[model samples]
Target: MNERITPASDPSTWGRALDEAVNILSRGGLVVVPTDTVYGIAADAFTPPAVQALLDAKGRGRQMPPPVLIASVQTLDGLATGVPAGARALAEAFWPGGLTLIVRAHPSLAWDLGETHGTVALRVPDHETALALLARTGPLAVSSANTTGSPAAVTAQDAYDQLGDSVALYLDAGEAPGQVSSSIVDATGETLRLVRAGAISLERLNEVTPVEGPTA
Candidate 1:
């Protein structure tokens, strides 16, 4: 059975909810959690089966790999290798918000997030509940909590309606601030390239580092 949790409740209640969500994730189960941008379906990134389950829930293929959400900017060094100067600049300027940096994945790590081509997209959301959960669960393979080609869920109910019982836990923190995803920048290249334009504008990204035109 699926469970709905309100992370905005009292401290003790919120703590329990976090525990439950963490427990589910530790067991290779999926959860629908709120981010600064939108609700996301998340699973343990290190567990290939769990990651695969997230893809199955979204009815998506390996070609579209899910990004990893982290609790802190410091975690980036552990997950990614060859972090460019532009990536660090962007993270310092826009992390804990809506900016995702795609960098080369650390070769030492053992996990499959599907067709990443040796790269991993990572982000640290600005939401308190998301950060709190990430603090406990570490990195999660997270994608917008909706079927492929559908509108991203801005509320937990919307996520539940689409994901149903496939998600073990739903942390309902009310509506998300934005309906858009994060601005994706490819940091693995010699020069930063805008992969997807969203909350963060191209002009803002260029202020920190030179950004090439949008990808084809």
Candidate 2:
């Protein structure tokens, strides 16, 4: 049975919820957590089996890797290499929000996110609960909490209906503000390319840095 945690409850309860979520993640177990955009299924990014299990839960394949949710913008450097000036500028402008930067992975990092092509997508979600959990678990490989090709879950219950017992814990912060997914920008190359457009509009991205490619 999955543990359902409402973090908005009393103080002691919130602490217990956080502890449960952290313990599950540390053991390479998957959890459904709230994000600014939507509910996300998260697992320890450093654990290959955990990451693979997340994919299996979603009925997804290695071709589509999950994005890494971070606690702070400062953690970006340790996970990615050759960060571009524009990427840094964008992070400063839109971080702690919906913006995923695809950058080259650290050469010596011993984690496989599957078909990442030597790169990793990193983001700092705007939700407090997610940040708090991320602060404890380091980085989590997170994706929309739904089966592959299904609509993203906007609430923990919606996620549970689909994911069921696959996730070890569910951090329910009520319904999420269902918005577009994070805007993805490939910063690994010299020219910043827009891979997917979502909450962050193209105009907004251009304001931070000159982004190339067709909008999603």
Candidate 2 TM-score, C-alpha based: 0.94
Best by lDDT: 1
**Total backbone collisions, model 1:** 0
Per-residue alpha-carbon lDDT of candidate 1 for residues 120-142, written as tens digits (9 for 90 to 100): 99999999888989998999999
Q: Best candidate, TM-score-wise?
A: 1
lDDT per residue for candidate 2 within 1-216, as digits (tens), equals 335645543445578888988999999999999999999999999999999999999999999999999999999889988999999999999999999999999989989999989999999999888887888889999999999988889888889989988998888888887456888999988799999888898899999889996655
Cα lDDT of model 2 overall? 0.89
- lDDT per model, in order? 0.91, 0.89
The CA lDDT at 176 in model 1 is 93
